[model samples]
Target: MNLAMKISDHDVLLVIDVQNDFCTGGALAVPGGEKVVPAVNRIAQKFANVVLTQDWHPEDHVSFAPNHPGKQPFQTIELDYGIQVLWPTHCVKGTAGAEFHRDLDIARANLVVRKGFRRGIDSYSALFENDKRTPTGLLGYLRERELKTVFVTGLALDFCVRFSAEDARKAGFEVAVIEDACRGIDLGGTVAATHQSFRDLGISVVGLEAFL
Candidate 1:
């Protein structure tokens, strides 16, 4: 379907984890990660409602590969919530790498939500932690502001952005993911599968042109 939709106050541009660590020269850099900032900045200017999310993890967070002996980044382990991917220490709380990319236009965002602070849990979605039930209060914030439709963008499309979009859709909000504004880790050839899953879930995976 063509998504030539116009922007409104009720439609939010949700920028997810476009942080220093996800960009070039950082520990967990995604391919073409830096390119997302300019696209997001341009897209954000056209929206009255905008929110940004950060992956703010603790030093000993369960998601970090260093936390588990003999584990390497991208290695999978069985946790209580099922499979969890161990990652190189990236977005630790209060660290420079945890901050948003310097070139990103954060001023356009009305609200910023930080997640993954819990030492025992890893959070990827802005709306919920990895468990899929732990609330990050993003849904309530949008509800209070009377915003419903969410256009998602930003770092690591297969992980954070994808999970956030899915959660927003499950929460009953109209959701679309801006493809050009996103970069994915694409671990284990998951990029194509991720887009398929997005379609299966009824989430519109569109380009920046949709809003133009």
Candidate 2:
């Protein structure tokens, strides 16, 4: 839909967590996760402003299942912020899994915002950590640059991409998720739920063709 939609200078493409850990043959790969790379690369060329978000966690990060006794990846646990899905130990800082996917083309990205770096908090949204109170400086950065809209794409449609798009909309930016340029973890029907949430929040779910 909206094939005529055009990217403007005031819009920024926010690429989320296309890191090694979320790709094929990695620590916490989303199914068919690496498939999004081509779509992302193709659409990214259409944008003048781009921001890339990385999940940079520590070995002892609270979100990792290994950090919590008797916990497994994808298990839910209550944290100080709220319920967080325990994830496999992934994206450890300075590890290969923490690096961007080798096939990703980041030539157009002007900013790379790393999140979930704090050992105690898990950050899913690019604008804020899991607590929803701590700022990641992304909102102010976007505001200062006068970027009024955000087009999101990347790994795990049900988690990081979903949170980032929702937060962007909540922060008063026009937000859209490039559906074809994303893959979902789809844990416990989360993909369907995420689409519903996007609709409720007025976040557009658009195809990559919108940018093409």
Candidate 3:
């Protein structure tokens, strides 16, 4: 809503899993997922610090539906942290689906943090794996850089983007989600729930105009 907000070096942009597997025609594609690329790329040019997180998983990663035998994608199962939705076999390490979207601008990124690589765990938050305490080292990197605020964007707003925003806020950084620069899978009103959760958590859900 703050159209005139000035972006500074302390305000870092976190691009969450804008990879081939989440884009248009991907194995786990979110509807309109590819639409966020241009806005994210455009916003990236304005940030002094840009960090990109990729959903890099191994072939037998625990989140995969194939590993669960009878389960299917989007089916909820209990994990140690809580219930986790089983996902399709995608973003396997060294696979084309694991790669960032072809049109995404990665040149401006200061750091590229790869997550969900460990075979036993699934990582939705860029800062922390699903275990919650296990860090991906992003917090330390941001702290070392003296960054204070995080502007988040990229694929599947209800999942990775939501988790990243919540974790960023919990890590003591002011957080904002660039709404227009994100798309959601939106299973069962998840997008609306995410918006309400963001409001409850005091995370700003702003339009692209907030930066432009």
Candidate 4:
């Protein structure tokens, strides 16, 4: 992609879930996830308005399978909030695996939104924790600062990245997800299914070139 284009101040760059837990050999590694580093870094450098989102959970966070008495990882359990899928313990607070991937150029970021810190709920979107408008303060900050659009790029295209983009759209911002700068766990099935889900909601999944 050409770097000649300029990114306006109203346009923000959303770095979604690039923590070590979602990268190679971590708690929830996505195949070839590490390969996205270069692309993410390059795209990040081109944007002046960048915000990063991290999955920060506790050791006993409800999302972890170990917290459930009889449930195991990858098992599905129903909660009052609806169906919650059990995930392996990952991105626990202050753990090495919870840190952002080493390859990312975080120094270029402006704000880092840490989510999923509550023991009873898990957060996949920067707009809210568990989709309930329990403020992550991201939307409010962006709105206060007058940021109108955000381009998302990071790990787990089907999960965190997807949810972030969807939430961005819901927050009344123009949303775009950089496909090549993301990697997915595919726990929800085919890549097409995930891409369709984003497209269904009007989120355009494209290369970083769009922003460039």
User: Considering TM-score, which of the candidate structures 3 and 4 is the better prediction for this target?
Assistant: 3
Residue 38 in candidate 1, Cα distance off native in Å: 0.9
lDDT of 1 by residue, 1-212 (tens): 46787787889999999999999998899987999988898898899988999998888899899999999989999988879999999998899999999999999988999999999888889999999889999999988988878999998899889889989899899998999999988888888887987989999888888767
Candidate 2, backbone clash total: 0
- Candidate 3 global TM-score: 0.97
* Runs of candidate 2 exceeding 4 Å displacement: none
Q: All candidates' TM-scores?
A: 0.97, 0.97, 0.97, 0.93
lDDT of 3 by residue, 1-212 (tens): 37666998789999999999998888899898889999999999899899999998999999999999899898989988888889999999899999999999999998999999999889999999998989999999999989999999998899999999999998899999999999998999999999999999999988887777
How many clashing residue pairs are found in candidate 4?
0
Evaluated at residue 11, the lDDT of candidate 2 is: 90
lDDT computed for candidate 1: 0.90
Model 3, residue 123: what's the lDDT?
Answer: 93
Per-residue lDDT of model 2, residues 1-212, tens digit only = 36667788999999999999899899999998999999999988988999999999889999999989988888999877789899999999999999999889987899999999999999999999989999899999999999998999998899999999999999999998989999998887999999999999999989866665
Give the clash total for candidate 1: 0
The residue pairs found clashing in candidate 2 are none
Off by more than 4 A, model 3:
none
- List the lowest-lDDT window of 10 residues for candidate 4: 1-10
Against the correct fold, how does model 4 do in TM-score? 0.93
How big is the positional error of residue 141 in model 2, measured in Å on the Cα after superposition?
0.6
